[model samples]
Target chain A: MNSSANSTMPIANRTVFFVSDGTGITAETFGHSVLTQFDMKFKQVRLPFIDTLDKAHEAVRKINEAFEKEGARPIVFSTLVKTDLAKVIFASKGMHMDLIQTFVSPLEQELGVKSTHTIGRSHNVADTEEYKNRIEAINFSLAHDDGQSDKNLSTADVILVGVSRSGKTPTSLYLAMQYGIKAANYPLIPEDFERGKLPSCLPAYKHKLFGLSILPERLSEIRNERRPGSKYASLENCRYEVNEAEALMRKEGIRWLSSTAKSIEEISTTILQEIKADVRIY
Target chain B: MNSSANSTMPIANRTVFFVSDGTGITAETFGHSVLTQFDMKFKQVRLPFIDTLDKAHEAVRKINEAFEKEGARPIVFSTLVKTDLAKVIFASKGMHMDLIQTFVSPLEQELGVKSTHTIGRSHNVADTEEYKNRIEAINFSLAHDDGQSDKNLSTADVILVGVSRSGKTPTSLYLAMQYGIKAANYPLIPEDFERGKLPSCLPAYKHKLFGLSILPERLSEIRNERRPGSKYASLENCRYEVNEAEALMRKEGIRWLSSTAKSIEEISTTILQEIKADVRIY
Candidate 1:
């Protein structure tokens, strides 16, 4: 924790570019992960869809301009697939980390094979079946959101049960979007608490159920923002509902996690891990 | 494209670990991106919340077991912040790539400073304000989905106007989740097409509006899956709706993109870039 002593040093501003042939999500995400380990602040720009030579040359110009303006070499993290485009960006006066080039050769040696070297396959609808599944999963998650449908619980890969506003909807959506999992979330309302069990439609599909719990104070705070000064937003009511929901889930042998301290990514990952769901898309 | 010749090679199956002290999202995403460059298949496992020495030791054991079982060293991509925990994982019998250690010192030297070396900062709810905004954005997007409400279009950061299933809902959710942008999606239905305009409430917020279009065949196919043999799912109807919608949007000076071939990530990124929206989350 004493690392804060370094704060006395002046912060340096650096220009960084995430250039890619497709959406640039992989480049930006991987580059940002590397950048987070550094203390220096970055003014980052994304240049996606640089699939053509003209676009690649334009990106090189932009990087060189940044280097000239800053009097320091910029850092370029690129995942361009074409050799010509990659060479164009690498020629810029910057520290270019060609992600695909860095690992593809080693992989070829290990696997005794060559890569496709095609652009946009990582984030494109190149596989028709996978694309259809992703869209179907998204539609399924949306249809099943918030106990809106009881017709397809049996078909869901996982069902997220939780109190209202306990991070169920976003987590379900994220699971669908990233992993192509058919995730359905049902809110635990007062009626479920009064019944001392889950909704009637959920028991048959209990194995697919995962529970989410949030801290009472946090739940109260979140609910207050939506409906201030309402009884539903009361701390006492939140505590009661959460306590009852947890007990019900525990009694039914359902696994649960606290959503208060976690992000949507964390919550969804935990659920996927616990359920041993097949990750259709990485 | 000739890379398919590599398919003749025997695929190597290796165990891969994406270990992190926080959500492991960065580790997984970055690792997956790297792994995609190779033709080898991987059995990937995620070990999140390895913030403690005990958890790190357990991770080491699991990694060693995978190595023993596979008769080859596993590949570990770790983003651990604590030095002690990172050292333990690095000592394992795998090709450990210490993501944080590999870059932190270089950054420290370049900036004439030190990093915070903080745990969980990358994917944690450490910033209460940011977390609150993300949740608020999710709520806003959900409430405004599918022309559900016109209550606060003026406050929205982006309003996506598109025909049904033109990749509106998922893109709106993604913008909300990843960037904390209040994205509202209004589906342009037959009524709007008949009227030759957008929704009545959208004109005042023209600057906030973005449009999505899709290939009529693709739209017809997607609709057919939902409502088979109906007018809404007819190719002629789809073509009419898409053509008219695009014409109306063009007349109104609304920028639009075809969603048929683009991934949700690409569509959302394009919109964000066009609007110059500040990406709040990395």
Candidate 2:
């Protein structure tokens, strides 16, 4: 239950940020950044959609319920939501939890503009004329690279191979977009796990082989989010699986990178560097 | 090419950032974040390898060259590669740039604890046991959703259909990771243009379709990055292609999203909310 935070306090005292516009990640990104910068200990909950006025009011009720259940105070960080809805939700629930609406006040002050009822984070870039195509290219490359059932691995400028749950995809996409490398990634799935060997497609390109290993407990927690009660998410199995995977990687002499806690930017760049691949120019 | 910063500046005056330690992305992440936050533009370059002492020395020489050429005072935010090599490099260079070594400074100042000489940014989240695995799952899902070959459109929780260079991949990854939704993307390649219809795979899943359109000049610039001198990357071609693609999408009654200046997070979430698909729990 994330006992890392004090659970006994009232909702108002403890900051509980339930960040979301109509979309969750946008709100979460800003909320996480601000939270990290301030070193504030807060419980973060993402409730993605609250687009309508009714849904916004409903969210307040849900927040109050969660606070009452936890016996703690809460603070909220909401982003890019409609002002009216945000006002209603914050006003109705402010007595219980302090709500920080991230985008509105500053945005309004800066541009003398309230959003034209738009629903997401504003794109602040140097070149709007060029950003669109870059975004589209990113989309094209992403759609083209799904590692499952794709046989054209040869076309990839770089290929990432890791056991299931190792950091490969984000690394690949980041490389593709940031540096314009045609990166492809394939998972070392359960079948490979059963064989106790790297997948067949890997060894031929072992020179480019990179592995991502993580600690078992972290794996368990992340897996728990996906499948809460299954043996697949069990800590014991995770430990065994991780140990076995690392051993196989070492025996195969496939150079590996540990992804435990490393962000996408770190993992991707590290893999590219270890492989000594050409510097991607975008 | 980027002749902005100069050398002969004091240690603190020069802002230098080295993006290496094998993972250029990690280095870039730290550099970009710090640089952006400070709004201090300086001479910046990425030296991707400093794994050995010799390589470290070579890196110093390259830095000297950049300093000499730019003539603008420099500052550095370097990723001091491996443990042994970092010590050697630091001793040789004697702390030149603004020199914010992410790993070293934090350990020394924050905990009054010194590191036992480790390489890379794994320490940022090094203690997380399952860090590698969670990253792997994200990468795997990212690979699977690439718009090109994941032809089983039926399984897509959301499918982004757009002209070439539309913001599809980032949007897909954002949806999958932030929302846990399996988003698939399909590009409107040139063949689709010649055929005068949407790709056959798209019509079957039209109900889940969302389109992304970009400003033509932005398309031109992105294409120029890929094929610098080609007519395909020409402004005229971009204009023609964009107009034709939009017409096709409009004719088909597919609700399209304009990706002119939207960040990937914004684009992805906006589409997810617009489609009202079931948000994935992760």
Candidate 1, B1-282: lDDT as tens digits:
001112343445568888999778767766766666655556678888898888899999999998899888887877878888988999999887655676656656655666777786666652356566776788899899999999988889999998898989989987887767899999888898788878899999999999999999999998998899999999999999999899999999999998988877778889989888623222
DockQ leader? 1
All models, DockQ values?
A: 0.36, 0.09
User: Using TM-score as the measure, which candidate wins?
Assistant: 1
Task: Estimate the TM-score of every prediction.
Answer: 0.90, 0.48
- Off-target runs (Cα >4 Å) in candidate 2 are A1-27, A30-74, A78-92, A95-123, A126-170, A174-282, B1-38, B41-147, B190-196, B229-231, B277-282
Put down candidate 2 lDDT per residue, B165-208, tens digits, no spaces.
66676767656544446677778867888899988767888888
